[model samples]
Target: MGSHEAKPKVLILGKVDFAHDAWNALTQICDVLNPASTTREDFVKECQSGKFDGVVAAYRTFHSFGITGLIDQELVGAFPPSLRYLASCGAGYDQIDIDACSARNPPLLVSNVPTAVDDATADVNMFLILGALRNFNAGMHSLREGKWRGRPALGHDPQGKTLGILGMGGIGRNLKKKAEAFGMKVIYHNRRQLSEELSGGAQYVTFDELLSTSDVLSLNLPLNNNTRHIIGKPEFAKMKDGVVVVNTARGAVMDEAALVDALDSGKVFSAGLDVFEEEPKIHPGLIGNQNVLLVPHMGTWTIETLIAMEEWAMENVKLAITTGKLKSPVPEQVDLQ
Candidate 1:
């Protein structure tokens, strides 16, 4: 067998879904050392030993790995001299230690499948909006309890609701289309306005205006310094009473305490959350709240997306290790390479 056919040492960090597609895609190029059912500590030790050539991190194992438990500064010491690429399975790279990786003598090429995740996330956003507006969680709970919620558990209609999107990027745009399909009027507040054509009839509104006017507010903004706690108590107070809030974005983007408070005060009618500020450690206040639906960050949790992500990640790892470049390095690292 050629050296290329020989399995290269690949380190698995945290939890990766060890499915047929994942293994087939990864194994075809390099051997996949996946210990998905194990603890995060073991993965850390493996990488730190510096014997691996490629590192793989995934999103499907969020429930097992917990929030922000993957790649971090503490685990950066494990990058063996052989390590060249740190391939992330999804677009959300908050768990990564970008600075630490960059400071290494030979910086790690961090790659994520950004484009492939948009449609899946957008589908999740619509699900959140519909689920929250329709109070699906509450109705389901009431039904399961052998009690008919009846009129008391009535859900709002999406036909005429206004959906205010905080970010108008790819995921946001896809969500707008889906929301509009349900007869919703889409409005958005982006860092900068997109061209008229790209807006797709989504009105350009100021952040405050969007907050006040939206009957359904969807948080799709990226997590960054300026966007942290973008939706808090003060912002909630400006929204339409009983507004539905859906967050498929990062948990820290909205203050969890504020969301719980708003839910209690009826400022937010219902909340469908796929991500939390302290994820896997859901806010205690949101627990048992009939108006809240919590998903363990499964916005991009579909077989198609997962397999595609794995394929892209392996391609990135192979390209980086063999050609000294990644197919899809994280945006900031693009310039560095």
Candidate 2:
């Protein structure tokens, strides 16, 4: 058989449920190379030794490659750089080094599953907001412990309460509609103002006003150089006392240390966190606290979202192979960092 007749080999790293759909989609078009679960070391060793023309990767694996410095010599350096693309299954390409790949041949395509993630994240944000305001987790725990005899009073109504949003992206705008449904007066701050339609009924406010006046503050901003530790000591100190904070955004956006301090001093009433600065490794200070609730970065873990992400990623990889293009290219508006 001619070299051109041979199917190009594709590699996928890590686990994605319903992966059969993704696997079939690729193998139907190209020769597929995949192992069920691969550790960082195995991943590096395999990518280094294997021959792959393209790779469809999980964002988590990219982070592993990033931290372990395996992306360079392994995936990126594999096969004299005739590789077609490195498509990330999730929205945040922060886990990958896009700029480095941009300089090489057989251009890498940085794509993401924005639609699925946005919906899942929006739902989680609202869940956190409602849960914190009503003390759902705490109350449930107290009830289960049979300590409900002298439990605290019911929470203040969300209706007419000020809802502050730190960013006005897709998830933020989605939360705005849900908050309004609960009769909240929404205010938001973003690097750039949102259009009237996307802004919903929320008012645009200065960061200071958002901090000092919001009854419940929801973070939807990304994690980056400027946004890292954005909700630190000074910002938390300026917030209204006992204000509830909900972070479904990246964990670094809210300073874990500062949040712990705020909760300790009663500056903030409570916090609902679905993500952390160092994920899978929680902050020791906040773990044992009764007032704080933690979820293991599961804002986008719903089955529906997971399936959607896998399908989108698989489609992109297939498209890149067939048409020399990507379906879900990362937009310039998004901070690639």
**Ten-residue region with minimum lDDT total, candidate 1:** 55-64
In model 1, which runs have C-alpha deviations exceeding 4 angstroms? 1-9, 14-22, 25-50, 53-70, 151-153
What are the per-residue Cα lDDT tens digits for candidate 2 across 182-276? 89999999988888877875799999999999999999987656788899999998999999999988888988999998988989888889989
Instruction: Residues 1-337, candidate 1: write the lDDT tens digits.
Output: 4864765656554454634564566557656565432556766665565445444322223343453265666766655666667777777777676877787667766887777889999988888888888888887788888887644468888998889999988799999989889999999999889999899878999999999999999998778667889888899989999899999989999999999898888888899999988756888899969889878888888888876776677677667656778888887688878
Candidate 2 regions off by >4 Å?
1-4, 35-42, 53-80, 105-107, 333-337
Name the lDDT of candidate 1: 0.77
Q: Which candidate has the highest lDDT of all?
A: 1
Question: How does candidate 1 fare on TM-score?
Answer: 0.84
